[model samples]
Structures are given as C-alpha cells and as structure tokens.
Target chain A: MQPVIRLEDICKIYGMGDTEVRALSDVNLVVNTGEYCAIMGPSGSGKSTAMNVIGCLDRPTSGRYYLDGIDVAGLSDDELAHVRNRKLGFVFQQFHLLPQLSALENVMLPMVYAGVSSAERRERAAEALTRVGLANRLNNRPNQLSGGQQQRVAIARAIVNRPVMLLADEPTGALDSQTTQEVLNIFSELNASGITVVMVTHEPEVARQTHRIVWFRDGMVQHDNMRPADLAQMTLTV
Target chain B: MNIIESTRMAVKTLTANKLRSTLTMLGIIIGNASVITMVGVGQGAQRYASQQFESLGPNVLFIIPGSEETRDRTFQVPRTLTLQDAEAISSQVATVSAVAPQLQTQQPLSFRNRQSNSLVMGTTPDFLSVRDFGVDRGRFFTETDVQRNTQVVVLGSDVARKFFDDTDPVGQQLRIKNISFQVIGVLESKGAFLGNNQDDAVYIPITTMSNRITGNTSPYGTEVTFISVNARDEASVSAAEFQLRNLLRLRHKVVNEDDFTVRTQKDALEIVGNVTGALTLMLAAIAAISLFVGGIGIMNIMLVSVRERTQEIGLRKAIGASQQDILVQFIIEAIILSALGGVLGTAIGAGGVMIVGAATPLKAGISTPAILLAVGVSGGIGLFFGVFPARQAAKLDPIVALRSA
Candidate 1:
C-alpha cells in the first residue's frame, strides 16, 4: 500500500552568510496509512522543522515530500496551503483556538476557507466537535474553557476537514498530567479509527504510547524503531 | 471566503475593540459632516441671494455713475450720470418703461422726542413702480413734487415705526438735518437686503435732494447717485441697455471710455453665482482633506492591528486560509468602519442644517448629492487606504508568524 507520507533526503537551511544554520539535513522517512508515530529529539535537534515539512507548512531547501502520493515539495505557497488543507491536520501545544470564536465557529473556520457551504460547514463542525467530546462546550469561547477542553476544541478543529494525517507539535506540553492522558487517549482513539497520527514530543511516556518512534539529533534522524508493546501484542494476537 | 462571511468577521473583530474602532472612525465622521454642512450652507446662500435679487423687480437694469475702473480708483464715486440723461432715456429709448433717479445719503432725522441716523433717498414717484415698493398709507408724490422741489418726505415702515411706533406718521412733520419736512406717506416693509434694512430708509424728491440736502456737489445738472430703469418686457432688457448706453455716450460727448456702466439683472446674477459656486468648491475641498487624513488614520490603525494579530493570521493560514482570505477580511473591516461613519455623519449634518434653517432666515436643507458624494468618497478612501495594511497581512509567512507567536 502507498504510504500516507514519504520524505526523501530533506534538507532545510535558515539565514545566509556567516549566520547560516541547518534546521534539517538529509532526512528520509516513511509512514504508512493508519500508523501512529512520534518524532523525538532534544532542543535544536530539528524535530519541529521535520514536523513543519511533514505538515506542508514549510518547504525544504532540497528534498522530495510526497503527501498521500503527490509530490508537494516544489508547490507554490497557495498550492501548499491547499495540500495542507486536504491531507494534513495540525495541533499545537498552545491549542491555538481563536480567542474570539466559539468552539463550533473555531471548528467551522477551516471549512470556511475550504469553501464549504454554510449548512454543510455547520453540520460537519457539530459532528467533529461531538467526536472530540466537545458537544456541550460548542458555544464556549477558548478563554471560557479549561486547558484540556480547549485542546479538545483544537482537536475537533483539526479533524473537522477529515485530513489524511494529524501532525501535532508537543500536543501535551501545556497540559497537566491528567489532561495529558485525556488528550493522548483521544489521539489513540483517532488513530485506532484509521487516521494516521504523527506527533513530536520530548516526553518518554508520550513517545512510548505511539506505535513507532523516530529519534533526531543534530538535524538528522538517528533511529527509526517500533515500540515493544506493539511488537509483543502483534506476536501474541497472531 | 464569501463576502458576507468576511464582513461578519470584520464586524465581530471591530466590535471586540469598540473604543479603538470608534476613535478610528472619528476623522471620517467629522470630514463628512463638514462637507455636507458646507454644501448645504453654500446652496442656502445662493438661494438667499437670488431671492434678494428677485425683490429688486423684474427686467430692471441699473445705470451707475463712473466705470468699474473709475469707481475702484477713486474713493469718492464721480457724479457723471445726470437727471437729464435719465429723462432722456425715459422719453427717447423705445424699449424703456420708466426711470427713477436716486440720491442717497445718511443723515440724522428727528421727530418730537425720538431721533435716528438713517439713510435718506431722493427719488421720483417712478421709484414706487421701478423698485416694486407699495405705500401702506397716504399717497406718493407725483411729477409736480419733483418740478416744485417740494420737501414732502415718505417714511419706510421701519423708520415710521422707529419714530411714531404704532401711530400713523402721514402728514406729520419730521426734521432732517434740522430742517422740518412733512411726511406724506409710509411704505410697507420691504425686508432687509444684503445686511442693510431696506425699511430703515426715508424717501424724498430728487430735485429737493439736490437743492436742499447734500447741495449739488457736481457742476453737472441735478447730479444723481444712480438711475434705475425698467424694461417694457424681460426680452427687451438687452435692447434697453444698448439704447441707453448709446444715448448716455452721446449725451456725455466724444468718449472712448464711457463714463458710466449699464448692468442688466442677468449680469449681476451671473457674477453672484460664480462667487458663491467657487466658495462652495473651496469649502468642500477643505473638508475633503479631513477625509484623506481619516483614511491615513485607518491605515495606521490597521497596520497596528495586523501586527497585533500576527498569531491569528498564522493560525488561520495553517488551517488552510489563502492570502486572499486575509486580505479580504482586513479590507472589509476598514470599509465597515468608514461606511458606518459616513452614515452617522450624514445624519448629524442633515440635522444641523434643519436646526439652522429653523433658527435663521436661511432656508438650508439637506443636500442629497452632497451626501452621496461624501459617503462614496469616504468609502473609497477606506478601500484605498486599506490595501497597504491588508497586503502586509496577507504576505506574512505562516511559519514565521507562528514561531513569533
């Protein structure tokens, strides 16, 4: 089967002249449909840059980025935005829900940009919020909701367009331990339902929850390995 | 995004910071108000001027002593026009109807106890028909009064009221420059013209004026201040003017530069129209500058708003918003502010005009074209000034924006 995302020899360089910095270098990776993966690294290890490339938010200096079988590395800014809209969903540690919009309106925003009709946008946003267990808080603004609820609203927004892969950067970094568990459980449930989930995290506990972990050090991938729990459970079930 | 949705979002964002939005709209409001008000006042002034001119009688022309250049150069106007010239035009000019010669001077008039320093005019009985004046009581002096150089005087309504109050002043004696003359008639009110109360003046015979009052300063026979002539019909005004100019030139004898000027009512109206129209344009232009300043204010605030909302822009872009979406949203916001201000300013300006009309003699009214133009200009300003900031917002990189946030 074709992988949901494929990156080949990706390199990202920032600035120019004496102050040049390499954010990502020669990174090749692949993740199939329905796979749950974690990108792990120390500070300045280029994990965020790799996430940005995978999310189609930024282009690499030299690379091939194939999202859902279409090469998107050389696309124009607007075309990249279209690809991101159709194939990728992003969740940030800050939740990033618009402070002025109600939770439902926040979820409906992507569909607005995507040119969805008003009726369909409303209905679909409601369904997405229900799936994220934010049906009761649909009319609440971000400031009116708790951290976990706000993150749940962000998740609802992310899945509102039904993107092919969810790319999260430190999704649980701002939440407490209890809220982190709730957020991770939602991610796991979403993944179990066959949506590919790729996350970047520094915490070992969060990394261990994923089916696979790719470690990065100094702008390059160091290891790509499957989790022990997934291996043992697969062996027992088979 | 759709226009309606963008407009809705713009309104929502602006209402979220009501004070800032209101302050940003203030310049446009003041600008539109001033423009509309000035246009209405200018139109009112034009109407008032025409109304005053209409009171001067139909198909009337004025023969003034001295040319425009001579009048400008000399402090005291030269007494070049004479009573014989007026009589000659009355009898010889075929298009002429009647002629009234006037000699006006300001002097003290006194009754038994009251006194007033007012204008005293010496004219013929033709003044009643030529100037469209009506005598309220008693009779106007005839040609006999002029030939006899009688000192019988006619008091205007206000002058009569000032000396005699509600009592009749006919056949009463009044002193002008300490010389007593009997009041033969009291005129009906003719209202004020160009700030001078026409009803505050008294009238007598031109012959008496030259003989008794400011005794003939000119060597010319029966020197008159000016001659007012009526045309037989409106169509004959130009013919009458031409005939009178030729007659006067012949009477004056061999003049390259004619000593007097003959002006029709149309000429006076055109000059007044030009002056008032130019003044209106100047006032409107001054008001438009405030609109431009308001537009610049909008641009300034919008740029600051874009900077403040950089993170919001990033988030929207990340979720698939195109650059056009961002641009439309900001531009719509600016339009909403300016358009709203325009509507409010129109209301205020119209209300002010109505109030002024009620309080003053000016019949000022709301001008529709002025309102439409002001609103259109302000809205266009909003759109024009909005582009720079909106483009700045749209060009922002989501990655850089998000990182900054």
Candidate 2:
C-alpha cells in the first residue's frame, strides 16, 4: 500500500558557512495510513525540525515531502496552510487554546478556519469534545479548567476538522503522570479509530505505545523498530 | 476573516480590559465635546453681530462729509447739500425713496420746570419715514413748516417721558437751547441704532436749525453735516447710491477726488459678515486641533494595546488567522472608538449652541454642513492615525510573538 507521508532524503539546514548547522540531513521516512509512529531523539537531535517540516510549518532546505501523495514543498504559504488545515491536526506542548474563548469555542476554531457553516461547526466541535471525554466541560474556559482538561480541549480542537493524521509535539510534557496516562488513553483510542498518529517525544514509555518507533541522533535516523503486540496492548488498555 | 467574526473577537478583547477601553474612549469623548462647544460659541457670536447690524434697516445710506485725511483737522467745510439738494434728490432720483438732510447738536431742552440734556436732530418731515420713525402723539412738521423755518419740535419717547411725564407734550412750548418751540408731535420709541439712543433725541426742522439756530451762511450754498437717504427697496439701493454720488460729485465740481463718502447698508453688512465669518473659521480651526490630539491619543493607546495582545495575535495566527485579519480587527476598533466620539461630539455641540442661544444676546444656529464636516474629519483622523499601529501589529512574526509569552 502507498504510504500516507513520504519524506525522500529530506534535509533542513540553518545558517551558512562557518556558522552552518544541519538540523536534518538526508532523512528518508514513510508512515502508512492507520499507523501510529513515535519519533524519539535527544535534545538538538533534529526531531523537532523533522516534525516542523512534516507538519508543513516550514519547508525543507533541499528535498521533496509528499503528504497523501501531494508535494508540500511547491505550495505557497496560504496553500500550505490549506493543506495543514485539511490533512493534519496539531497538539502542542503548551495546549495553545485562546484564553478568552470557552472550551467549545476553542474546539470550533479549526472548523471556523475551514469555512464550515456555524451550525455544522458547532455540531462537529461538540462531537469532537465528546470523543475526548470533555462533553461536560465545553462551556469552561482554559483558566477555569485543569491542565488535563485544557489539553483535552486542545486535542478536541485538533480533531474537529477530521484531519487525516494527528501531529502531537510533546503531548504529555506539561501534564502530571495520571493526567498524562489519561491523555495517552485518548490518543490510543483515536489511533484505534483508524486515524494516523505521529507523535514526537523523548520519553521511552511514550514511544513504547506506538506501532513503530524511529530513533534519531545527531540529525540522522539511528533505528526503526516495529512492535505490533505492544501497540495492540496499549490500545486494549485504553 | 469575515467582519462579523473579527468584530466579535475585537469586542471580546476590548471588554476583557474594561478600564483600558474606557480610558481610551474618554480622550475621544472630550475631544469631540470641546470641538462642538467652541465652534458653536463662535458661530453664535457671528449671528449676534449680524442681527444687530440688520436692525439698522437695509435701505438707508449714510454720506458723511470730509475725507479721512481731513477728518481730524478743520478744513474748508463742504457746502454741497442744502434743502434744495434734498428736494432735488427726492424728485429727480428715480430710486430714491426719501431724503432726510440731518444736523445734530447736543443741547438742554426744558418743558415747564423739567429739563434734561438731549440730542437735537434738525431734519425734514421725510426724516420720520426715512429713519423708520413714527409719530406716536401728533403730526410731524409739514413742508410748509420746513419752508417757513417754523420753531416747532417733536419729542422722542424718552424726552417726552422725562420733560412732559404724564402731561401732554404735543402743542406745548418746549425750550431748546433756551429758544421756545411748539411741540408738534412725539416720536415713537426706536430703541437704539449704531450706539445712539434714538429715543433720547428731539427732532426739529432742518431749515430752522441752519437759518435760526446755528446762524451760518456758506460761501458755496447752505451747508449740512450729512444727508441720509433711504432707497425704495433692496434692489434700488445700489442705483440710488450711484445716482447720489454722481449728483454730489457734479454739484461739488471736483476735478479729482470727492470729499464725501457714500456708504450703503449692504457695505456695512458685508464688512460685518467678513469679520464674523473669519472669527468663526478661526475658532473652528482651533477646535479641530483638539480632535487631532484625540486621534493621537487613540494611536498611542492602540500601540499599547498591540503590545498587550502580542500573545493573542500569536495564538490567533497559530489558529489560522491571516495577517489581513489582524489588520482589519485593529483598524475596526479604532474606527469604532472615533465614530462613537463623533456622535457624542455632535450632540454636545448642538446642546452647546442651544445653551448659548438661551444665555446671551447671540443666536446660535446649528449648521448641518458644519456638523457633517466635523464628524467626517474626525473619522478620517481615526483612520489616518490607526494605520501605523495596525500595520505594526500585522507585521509581527507569528513564531516570535508566540515565544514572547
């Protein structure tokens, strides 16, 4: 089967001459539809750079990136934004929900950007919040909710547009262990529903729950491990 | 972004910081109110001056003797106007309504034992009509009385009130400059004209004053200080003025400059209008400065707002808001503030005009064109001052902004 995301010798460099530093060098990667993958690396290991490139937030220095068989490097800024909105959902470490908006309004943001009608956007946002087990907390603002609930609201916002894949950058980095486990459970449930999930993290336990793991060191992939039973057990526990 | 969604977000953000919003709006409110009130007061003064001038009548023309150069010194006095000259103008000048040759002197007049310092005006029967005076008690001196140099007098309302009191002054003997004259009539109350109290003056025959009172005979002709002529209407005023100037010039036989100045009511009104109009414009201009200061206030506050909401801008951009969306949001906020101020200013200005009209002799009229211009200029100020800060907000890099918090 064709891969959902294909990165061919993707390279991202910062600065030039004596000040030059290569964040990602000749990296090739693939993730098929319905697969859950985790990218693990140490600090300054190029994982974040790779994630930024894959998320269409930044272009590669010299390489082709294909998402669902569409070339992302050639698209303009606005066109890339359209692709990001339609095909990828993002969950950031800070849970960047607008503080002035309620949980439901935050969740409806992606659909609003998608140009969905008000009635339809509200309905879809409600469904997304319910899926994240935040049905009762829809009217609450970010400051009024716990850290876990706010993160869940962010996740609901990510999935509101029904994107093809979920891109989480340090999803549980700011949460307590218990809240982290609860959020992991939500991610596992989403993965079981057949949405492709690609998470970037440094934690081994977080990586152990994914179907495949790609380890990076000094801007190059070190290993790729596929552990089917571990992914199965993680989904079953959630 | 759609305007509705942008406006909703703007309102939400502004409401979150109520104190800041109110403070920002205060500048605009005060600015608008001051502009309205000052301009209204200025306009009121202009109207008052014009109305005062209008009460002097529209058809009357004043021809004062002596040029500006000879005004202070006693030169050869002109003897151009006489009783015959007044009669000739009345009959020959087609546009001339009436001619009242006047001679004025300050003297003491007495009736019975009552005496008062009063103004004595030596003029013909036509003076009553030309000067907009009417006899309240008895008939004015006729042409026969003027020709005969009759020692008959007419009492002004105040003169009658002071010397005659409740007693009848008509047909009674009154002593003017110690000369007894029969009171033929009582003049109506004319209030005041050009600072002279018309009600305190006594009217006698001009021929009597030139022949019997002053006792002077000119080498050229019978001399009079000034001649007052009334035109038939507003349309005939200019024609009568032209005819009188030509007639006087021909009679004086001047090879160069004439010694007399013929000033029409319209000339006086125009001078008054120009002076008042200029004053109004200057006041309005000063008021506009305050509006500009208010705009600057808006700009300063908006810059602060942009700084305060840096994180908000980042988050919105992250959620897919375009740069244009941010620009539109900030610009709209400024426009809303200024437009609100304009509305408030208009109301304050109208109220100020009304208050001035009530409190003083001036009539304050609310000019619609001025109001529209003021509001439009204020809003334009908002839009102009709002652009720089809005652009600064829009040009902020999203990544840098997100990292700022």
Candidate 3:
C-alpha cells in the first residue's frame, strides 16, 4: 500500500526545569492513501498534538515525519507552510471561518495563498462550495449561516486548493446530532471520491463512521482497530 | 499574499469600525490645519511688509542720525544731520539721484471754522520723487519757495479733506501755529506706513519751516530730521550708501563710531522676516506635538486590535499563512489607517488656509510642500508606530491564540 503519512517515534515535550510535560512520546503511526480513518482518545491523550504535527502546524521534539513521502521533520517554518498549503487541509471544531469575508471569499483564501490566478481561484472555490452543498449560500457571511452550514463552508475552504489529505480536529464536536450526521455524510462522500480523511475525536460514534480507528492513551497509542474487510472495501470502491 | 490583497483586507477591517477610525484621525487633522495656517499667514505678513517698503520709494535709503543702537532709545533722533549735509551729498555723490531733507513738527492747523492737530513736514522739492508722493492738484512748491522763505504748503489728501471739506484745497489759506500759509498743491492718497497714517501730514518748504515755523536753525547749517536719499538705480544703492557714509564721516569729522546710520529697505524687511519666521516655527513645532500624539493614538489602537484579533491571526496562520504574512497584514491595517488620516487632514488643512485667507488681510496661499510633508510624516509615523504591535501579533503561538479565543 502507498502510504500518505508515516510517523516514526514522534515525541513532543512542553516546558522544562522539572515542570516538563511530555505531550507525545514514541508515537508511531501510518495511514495509506485514500484511507478514511479517525484518531480517537480521551483528554490529554496527545491525539490533538498528533493532529497538529501531521498537519505541519507544530514540530515534534524528536521524530521523523514523512508526509506524502516528503521528509517534513527537517522542514523550516516557511517550508512547513508550503507543505501545509499543498499537502494537507485542516478543519477545526470551532469552524474557523473569517467573519469579514463571504462564504465564497472565505473558500478562496487558500488558493490565494497558493498563488492561483484569481479567475481560476474563483471558479474552483465556487465548485468546492457546490460540492459541499453550499452553492446557494456562497455569498452569505459566516454569522448568517447556520452552525452546520458554517462547518460546510469551512469544509469548502479546506478543500478549495485540492489538498491530498483532509485533517479534521473535533470537526463535529460543536454540532447537534442531526447536523453531526450531515457533516459526517459529507466527509464520507468526500472520501468515496478518492481523498484521504484523517479525523481526531473523543466521540466513539464519530470514530465508528470511519473505516479504521487508532486510539491513544497517556501520550502513547493504546489501540488499533483496522478491519481488513473495510480496507478491502475501501480499495475496491476507490 | 500580495500587497494588494493585504491592503484590501486591511480596508475591509478598518471600514467596519468607522467611528474609531475618524476619532483617531482628529489629532492629525487639527495639527495639519494649524501648521498650514500659521505658515501661510507668516508668509503673507512678509509679503505685505515688502510691499510697504516698495511703496516708500524706488531704491531709497534713510539716513537716520545716531548709531543703530540708540535709534529707538529717544523720540527725537538728536538732529545730527542737516539740510547742508543733504545738499552736499546731492552735489558730490555721483550715484546719488536725489535727496530730500525733512523737518517735522506737530502743530494745530485751522481753515475757516475747522481746527485739528496735524503733522507738518518741511522738505525740499526733491521730496516729491524721493518719498514717492504725487501732486494731485495745482503744483508743488519750487526751489525759489525755500530761498525766498515763501509760506506755501501742500496738503495731504486726508488733511485736504479735513480742513477744506473735500473742496479743492489748492490756492486756499490754512493757519499752522497761528501763521497763515497758502495751500499751493494737494497730494494724492498714500496709505499707512508702519501703522502711521501717511495721508494726514502736510508738506512745506524746508527754509520756511526753519525760519517761520520751528525757528530752530543753528550755525551747523540748519538742524533737520532724517534725509531721504534715492540712488540712481537699484544697482547703485549699496555703492551710494558706502559713498554717503564716507562723506558723512568726513563732514562730521568723526574719528570713532560714525554718527549716522544708513538703513536700506532690505535691512528692515530682514528684521521683520526674522520675527515672523520665529513665530511661524514656534507655532508649527507646537502643532507637530499633536501630530505626534496622533501617531501614539494609532499605536495604542493597533495594540488593542491585535489582542482582540488573536483568534483571527491563529486562523490565518493555520490556513497556510506564514508569520511574515500575519505581520504584513497587521502592519497594512495600521498604514491604511494613518495614510487615510493623512489625506483627510490635508484636505481639511487646505480648507482652513483658504478660509483664513478669505477672512483676514493675510492673503495666505496653501503651501504644497507643507501638505506633502504632513502626509508623508503621518504615513511614516504609521509605519514606525505600527512595528511594535505587528511584531507582537506575529510572535503569538497559534496554539495559544486558538485556545485563548
């Protein structure tokens, strides 16, 4: 299998002088291309830290990070930004949509940073918003949209530049059960279309929707429930 | 992101809070207005003084008795110059074109039932050209009028109007110090000089003034007031002044400091210019303090804005923005605020200058360099003051920023 992300003994420590806290230690993980999975854990289990490192937002204290076969651990801050821009898309629990911009404009932001031409950026941003079922709400601001719709807009923004992997941190943590299902369905549809989706969450129900689950406890991986049937099915479908 | 995108975002953010932006710009506006107005008025006053000197005479110099140090110490200038000195300069100095020696006294004048205290000046026929006065009616007294000691007077316009009731004052009789004199000519209007009205004085023959009026003639060839001398041309003024000084020192037999001081129009204008220039500088410096305060106001607001928008910064960073990007965005916001303030202040200051020009005797014009300077300074201030808050915002950890909000 072609791997999309490979982590070797990653460690992240915070503070020093006897107050040092190891947020992550010896965390080895890998996800294949086009896989739909979730990283699940309790509070302080370092799943969030793992997500940050994988997304290239934070560097690990000691580790080897190979994102899409690119050695990201040795990357400088500027190079990491380029990796984040081209290799990964991020979604937060808070639905971080800039309030001043319209839904379409918010979706256009990543492509703007990607140095995409304005005409193409607009066309692709509109297409991404259409894919998220937000075609009609493209001009609406974040405050005017419902919570679920805002999350959908954020999804469109994350995917507008056509990233290789979508990394979500508690993506449905703030939503009602009905909207949670709606967002999860969108994620499943995105995965079926040949995109890798790696999600971090404490909710078992959210974890169950994914094909595989990696559980963490006390700064280390404690469980891996990768079903062979689901993997075969994922390959066959894609 | 490009500068254009950053600027666009900055505009959007600033326009969201219109009241705060306008209030922040008020200090710069007032500062610019005062600077423009004070400088414009100062320039206008200088121009007005130069015009007054031009109207005095063409290439004229005043030979005042005594040194420059004691010119203002006494009311009367100690009569060290004489009518004979003026004649000697007119005859001997090749650069000298004309010379008019003046003798002055304040005396009550009467014509029919009207009576008033008036300034009476006794001068030669050369006074007509040397003092730039024109005879509006009849004719000025001839040189024979002084040798014969004829009691003939030329009335100034205001004096003519006061004593003769606007009737032709020529050929009329007027009494000065209770002595009857015939008005042979009437002078045209000459406006105020150094706050003293030039149109209220009457002119007479210098010999008649010494013989019949003041009767203060001495053996030193008739004591007189200042001598007004006109050079042959503008190029000859300094040469004539130097020659006159040497002639006077020899005539007065001075071995130490010279007894007479020659004053040029340029010298008087320089003194007036220095005073007005200092006044303008002081006023502008005071106004610049307010501009400085306005820059501090921008910095204060930017700091508060950075704190309030921490989450936004984190979001931008999370979405592929580098630290440099965040820094540029905040810095652009501050620059937009200050540059916009500068433009608005310039418009207001130009308007104020025009208003002051319209309402007062100072015909102040809007100075282009002043506008450019004020605007450029404010923009630079925005850049200078903006660095602190922009750096602060750029340095925040995205994890902490996202967590805080």
Candidate 4:
C-alpha cells in the first residue's frame, strides 16, 4: 500500500548567511493509511516544523513533499489550503476553538469553509460531536466547556470535514492524565476505523501508545520503531 | 468561506465585544447625525430667505440713482426722476402696470406730546399695489391727492398703534417734522423688508414732500429720489425693465455705465442662495471630517481585533479559508458597524432637526438627498478605513499564527 504522506529528503531553513538556522535538515518521513504514528523529539528537534510541512501549513525550503501523489512544494497558498481542507485535519495543543462560537459552531467551521449548506453542516457537525462523546455539549461555548470537553470539540472539528488523516500537535499537552487517556482512546478508535493518524509528542508514555514511533534529534530522524502487538497491549494496560 | 458564514462569524465577534463596538459606533452616529442636521438647517435658511424674496412680489424691479463716482465727488443729489418720467412709464410703456415715485426723509413724528423718530415716505396711491402693501385701516391717498398735493398722511399699522393706542387715527392729527397733518388712512402692517421696519413709517403724496416739505425745486419739474415700477405680471417684468432702462438712458444721456442699477427680486434671491448654499456645504464638510475620524476609530478597533484573533484566523486558515475569505469577513464586519451607525445617525439627525424646529426660530427641514449622502459617506468611510486592517489579517501566515496560539 502506498503511503498517505511521503517526504523525500525535505529541508527547511530559517534566515540566511551567518545567522542561518536549519529547522529541518534532510528529513524523510512516511505514514501509511490507517497507521497511528507518533513523532517524539526533544525541544528544538524540528518536530513541529516537520508537522507544519506535512500539514500543508508551510512549504519545505527545498525537497519534495508528496501527499497522495500530489506534490505540495510548488502549490500556491490557496491550493495548499485546498489540499489541507480536503485531505488533512489538525488538533492543536491549545484546543484552538474560536471562543465566541459554541462547540457545534466550532465543529461546523471546516464544513463552512468547504461551502457545505448550513443544514448539512449542522447535521455532519452533530454526528462528529456524537462520535467524540460531546453530543450533550454541542451548544456550549469553549469557555463553558471543561478543558477535556473543549479538546474533544476540537477533535470533532478536525474530523467533521472527513479528511483522510488527522495531524495532532501536542494534543494532550494541556490536558490532565485522565482527560489525556480519554482523548487517546478517541484517537485509537479513529485509527481502528482506518483513518491515518500522526501525532507529535515528547512524553514517553504518549509515544508508547502509538503503533509506530519516529524519534528526532536536532533536525534529523535518529530512530524509527514499530510496536509489537504484545508491547502495544502492555502499554495500553499500563 | 461563504458570505453568510463569514457574516455570521463577524456578527458573533462584534456581539462578544458589545461595549467596545457600541462605543465605536457612537462616533459615527454623532458624526452622521450632525452632518444631516447642519445641512438641513443650512438648507432651511436658504429656503426661508428665498421665500422672503418671493413674498416681495415676482419680477419687480428696483431703480436706484446716483453713480458711485458722481455721488462721491459732487455730494449733491441729482434731480433725475420727475412726475413726467413716472407718467411716461405708466402710460407710454405697455408692460408697466403701475409707477410709484418715492421721496424718503427722516422726521420726528408726534401725536399730541408723544414723539418718536420715524421714516416719512411720500408716494402715490399706486404705492399700495406696486409695493405689495395692503391697507389695514382707512383708505390710501388717491390720484386726486397726488394732483392736489394734499396735506394728508397715511400711518402704518405700527405708527398708528404707537400714536393713537386704541383710538382710531383715521381722522386724527399727527405732526410730522412739526407739520400737523390729518391721518387720512392707516396702512397695513408690512413687516420688516430687508431689515427696515416698514410698519414703523408713514406715507404721503410725493408732490406734497417736494412742494411742502423739502422745498427743493428744479426748472424741469419736482425731482424724485427714486421710482418703483411694477409690471403687470412676471412675464411682463423684463419687458418693462428693458423699456424703462432705455427711456432713462435717453433722459439722462447715459453714454457709458448708467447712473442707476436695476435688479429683480429673483436676482437678489439668487445671491442669497449662493451664500447660504456655500455655508451649508462648508458645514457638511466639517461634519464629514468627524465621520472620517469615526472611520479611523473603526479601523483602529479592527486592527486590535485582528491582533487579538490571530489564533482564530490561523485556525480558520488551517481549516481551508482562503485569504480572500478572511478579508471578506473583516470587511463585512466594518460595513455592518458603519451601516448600523448610519441608520442610528439618520434617526438622531431627524430628531435633532425636529428639536431645532420646535425650540428655535430656525425651520429645520429634512432633505432626502442629504440623508442619503450622509449614509453613503458613512459606508464609504467604513470600506476605506477597513482595507488596511483587513489586508493585514488576510496576509498573516497560518504557521506563525498557529504557533502563536
């Protein structure tokens, strides 16, 4: 099976001349459909930069980036946005739901951008919230919801567009251990349903829950490992 | 994003910051209201002045004597107008309806012992019709009185009231310049014309003033100060003016500029209209500056809003909103603010006009075009000032914005 996202020797640099900083240096990455992968790295290891490139939020300085065989390096900002909208969804550490909007409205946001009719957008957003166990909190604003509920709403918003992959950057960073496990279960269920998931995290426990892990040091990948079924079951029990 | 969704989001955001939005709208409201009110007042004043001019009778002409240079050098009054000229215009000129010669002088008026300074005008009986004056009491002096140089006077309504109180003054004696004359009639109250109170004066025969009062004689005939000619109607006014000017030129042998100026009531109104129109425009412009300031305030607030919503913008962009979508959202927000302000301002402005009309001598009128202009300008201010902040929001990089979150 082809990889859903494929990067060949990607490089992204910041500044120039004597002040150059290589945020991503000769990075190669792949995540196949239906796989749950976690990228683990210390601070300043270019993990977030790699996520940005994969999310189509930024272009690589040099090197090819292919998502479902479409080269995104040369795509214009609007075209990149189109690709991001149709193929990938994002859940951020801060649970970046618009404060003014209710959970239902926040979930409907992606469909709104996709030009879905209001009636259809509401129906799909309702279904997405139901899937995230937030059916009772649809009309509640971000402030009205708990940190866990808000993140769940963010997750619902990410999947409402029915994108091919979910890209989570520090998804549980702002959550407590209980809420973190609840969110991880949702991610696991989504991946079990054949949706590709790529998450960026620094916590060893969070990394252990994923099916595969890629470790980064500085700007390059230092190790890649797949968890055996026994190890995955032991990690889940812990 | 679609316009409906963008507008919905904009409204939600604005409502979330109700106090700030309401305060910002106040500036535009005051600016637009004041603009409408001031323009209405200025327009009302112009209309009032024109109405006053129109009340003086249509197509009537004024003939004032004495050239600027000649009057300054000689310091001597010219004996130009005579009864012969008045007769010539009245009978010979087909367009002339009536000709009334006037002799004006200041005099101390006394009824018994009560005395006051007043203008004494000597004119023919046709003065009543020609000058648009109505008799409120006894009859005016007749052509017979002009021929006889009668020592009878007509008191204006105010003069009659001052001298006689409640007593009828028609058959009473009134001393003018120490000359006792029987009051033959009481003229109607013709309110102030061009600042001079007409109801405070008295009128007599022009011949009586030349022969009995001033006592200045010329070999040609009794000299008159001025001649007021009334045309039959508006259509005949110009013809009468043309004929009279030619006749006067012939009589005075005016080879260069005439020793007189002829003006119609319309011409006077036009001059008044120009002055008031310019004043209205200037006042409207000043009010528009305040509107511009209000627009800037909106822009300032919107810029602050963009800064505060950086994460929200990034999220929207990440969710696939194009830059144009963000731009539309911000611009639509501004337009909604300004449009609401404009509607509020129009209501306030109309109320202000009504208040002025009720409280002051000024007649405040609401002009539809002025209201439309005020609203249009307000919307334009919104669009113009909204561009910079909206562009800034649109140009933000989603990566940087998301990182900031």
Model 1 score (lDDT)? 0.89
Which digits, one per residue and each the tens of the lDDT, describe model 4 over residues B32-83? 9999899988887787777778887895777766665666767675676676
Give me the candidate number with maximum TM-score: 1
Question: By DockQ, highest first, what's the ranking?
Answer: 4, 1, 3, 2
- Cα distance off (Å), candidate 1, residue B26: 2.3
lDDT of each: 0.89, 0.81, 0.85, 0.86
Docking class of 2: acceptable
Q: Which ten residues in a row have the lowest lDDT in candidate 1 chain B?
A: B49-58
Q: TM-score: which is higher, 2 or 4?
A: 4
Q: Point out where model 2 deviates above 4 Å.
A: A1-4, A202-213, A222-238, B62-92, B100-128, B131-228, B252-265
lDDT of 2 by residue, B1-405 (tens): 687776777777777777877777766666676677767777777766766667658988878776545555676656555656677788888898888988877888887788889888888888878877888989899989989999999989999889878888888999998899999899889886645788998989988988877765566566677788899898888989999888877877767777777878777778778888888888878777888888999899999989978877765665565667778889888887777778787888788878888987677778777777777877787788888889888777655666576
Question: How does chain A of candidate 2 score by TM-score against the true chain A?
Answer: 0.94
- Give the C-alpha lDDT of model 2: 0.81
For candidate 3, write residues A131-219 as lDDT tens digits.
99998988998999999999999999888878889999899999999999999999999999999999997776787789888877789
lDDT per residue for candidate 1 within B1-405, as digits (tens), equals 799989988988999889999999998898888888888887777777777777786699999998889888998887888888889999999998989998999999999988999999999999999989999999888899999999899998999999999888998999998889999999889899877999999999999888899897576688999999999999999999999999999999835888898888887787778887888888788888888898899999999999999989998899888888999999999999898888888888888778878888877778889999999988998899998999999999998888775
Candidate 3 lDDT, B283-390, residue by residue in tens: 778878888888899899989888988888887777778778888988888777787788888787778778878896666777888778888888888898889999
Q: State in Å the error of residue B85, model 4.
A: 4.8
Residue pairs of candidate 3 with colliding backbone atoms: none
User: What is the per-residue lDDT of model 2 for residues A11-100, given as tens digits with 9 covering 90 to 100?
Assistant: 999999999999999998888999899987778989988988888877899899999999997886567667877888888888888887
